[model samples]
Target: MAKIILNRENLFHNLNLISKQAKGIEKVAIVLKDNAYGHGLLEIAKLASEYGIKKAVVRTHEEALKINNFFEDVLILADVENSTYSHTFHIAVNSLEQIKKLPINTKVHLKIDSGMHRNGINKKQLKEAIIGICEQNLKFTGLFTHYRCADELSTDFYWQRSNFEQIKQEVKSTCEKLSIPTPKFHSANSSALFRVKDFDEDFARVGIATYGYLETDTIFNNPKLKPVMSFWAQKISTREIKKGQRIGYGGSYFAKKDMTVSTYDVGYGDGFLRLNEKHKYITPKGYKILGRVSMDNLSINSQDEEVCIFDDVRQLAKIHDTITYEIITTLNPNIKKEII
Candidate 1:
């Protein structure tokens, strides 16, 4: 008894809208990292490719292979430790070891640390790393980095991107001597590209953005973007609750007085894992979320009203004390996701 509906139309629009943000680009890589951020890789990525999305990015080496079977043209941006010599898809390599060992003819990218403290080569070691790779000729087709901040304009963000400038200069000089196209450069993620105009890159590896989500006010303020995923559920049952009646597990909620109650056939197991008592729910006809969320069920105070589950993720997260990413990614198959 799942009332959830996935609006394929909105999803498509979201992807298109985000992609359109990159003006005059010959090709754009639709990031499919994290199973397309839980939108279902096979379905969403296939649709993206069908819509002429020429490229895509994933997190791990295994993920690259998982999508490659379906998307032969996927442009994988993560490192593949076990990849063979002629494997299809671009890879992001970190250090001298990878540059030395990676197959010479493979299409791969050299990633710089930039200041995220997560991955890539450090600024101090940039020139040395580039020289080593160019000398060995590891098919250095691209150079990129991850933006630590695009949600806020602060010193943290500045220093992170500053390294990109430094690395870009070094790599450009080396690429010229090695006779490679100034390895197409890219660094900004969703929040950066959508929010700050100057933060644009040759190619932005967008995941949440394509799904119609801008992490902060900077991008959400952009009237051009739209919410692609409108999550919906149905109000299966409604009844009146008497005073003093305890609601849900552990008696977490109790009726202050006689009131209307509704049941939604989804709970924590169904990706409704909000432990907050003030969480809300929306049905095709109305909105509410009443008591403790169970493994396969949750209660909502329906005042006999109805709304589709196809509301905004922002609303659900407000009710659940979590984030939009968690709500969407954590949703289990316990609730059906049908494209509308």
Candidate 2:
């Protein structure tokens, strides 16, 4: 079976960098959505907690419940529960309608669609949202907005930041007029946090950077972060292929000369990307993958009992024309993860 190994030292190193950029560890909220981006929720949560992290961000209330014991604050990005509110859980109010659905006395962070216009309420609806939050008896604790292209070299980031600043001021004034406590403001993710020279936020909702993959453009002087996860697979069987013999489903690969090959127990079925023979994928150790990747295995020219599928996914993501987030998050959660 394929397995995942997490580097504890690398994780701590990344967190240290994030903490420095965030101005302090207290200002960092590790994003644990989608099973810690498929690095194993419980596994990463334990490590984060051990590293003195106090806050976490997840996609659902259900995910928060699993790691509540690991953090002082758990922010649910997109789910609300009717159950009694706990100080440990804070839901993000994406819409006025969502505010109405939240239980009375539930703590929430208002998400403003400053410019991304994806989730969150529009900036124009600020007063309406405040009124709803007050009327609904929800506790407004924070306000945040997502950047659309903070990683790219574009002026859009500045444009969005300017918009969020306006929204923040409006929120503060409206809260003051309504006699509501001033809510904390945060507008940076991993990329945006690094883009700015000054780090001033209640919390930076850091995701990929915490796991050691910064996606900023090379033109920017991005910090060098170490990858925390490595994937490995065990050899299931081995055989010798004679010269001129074909291999795999469509016979897309044939040995020019005799060579020893082994099928490794890792494939798309286990959330790994399947490669066709035309691409000629090779392992980090320089062993060539011999044929089309199978549903449960792939033949590689190696006899080692265990082979490293990837220690870092950036190159693999480039080969597949996808992002590192997709590459890591697509990994099957069922795979065992060990912190080294």
Q: Pick the candidate with the highest lDDT.
A: 2
Superposition error at 48 for model 2 (Å) = 0.4
* Residue 85 C-alpha lDDT in model 1: 34
**Candidate 2 backbone collisions, by pair:** none
Relative to the unseen true structure, what is the C-alpha lDDT of residue 263 in candidate 2, on a scale of 0 to 100?
93
Off by over 4 Å in 2: none
Q: Candidate 1 residues 1-340, lDDT tens each?
A: 5544555677777666666777633345778877666666666776776666666788777777776755544455556474473355777778767777776666777788887789887777776776776677556667888877667656676777776887788878877876767877888677766665544567777777677676665524663555555544456688888999988888878788998887766667767565666544554455456666778767777643334554567766666666677777776634444556
Candidate 1: misplaced stretches above 4 Å?
Answer: 1-4, 25-27, 69-80, 85-87, 134-137, 198-200, 218-221, 232-240, 256-262, 278-284, 301-307, 319-322, 333-335
Model 2's lDDT to the true fold? 0.90
Count of backbone collisions within predicted model 2: 0
Best by TM-score: 2
Per-residue lDDT of model 2, residues 1-340, tens digit only: 6899999999999999999999999999999999999999999999999999999999998898899899999999978566775688998988878877888899999999988879999977889999998898889899999999999999999999999888888888898899989997998999999999998778899999988898999999898899999999999999999999998988988889999999999988888888744466777898888778888998899999999988888888887888999999998899988889
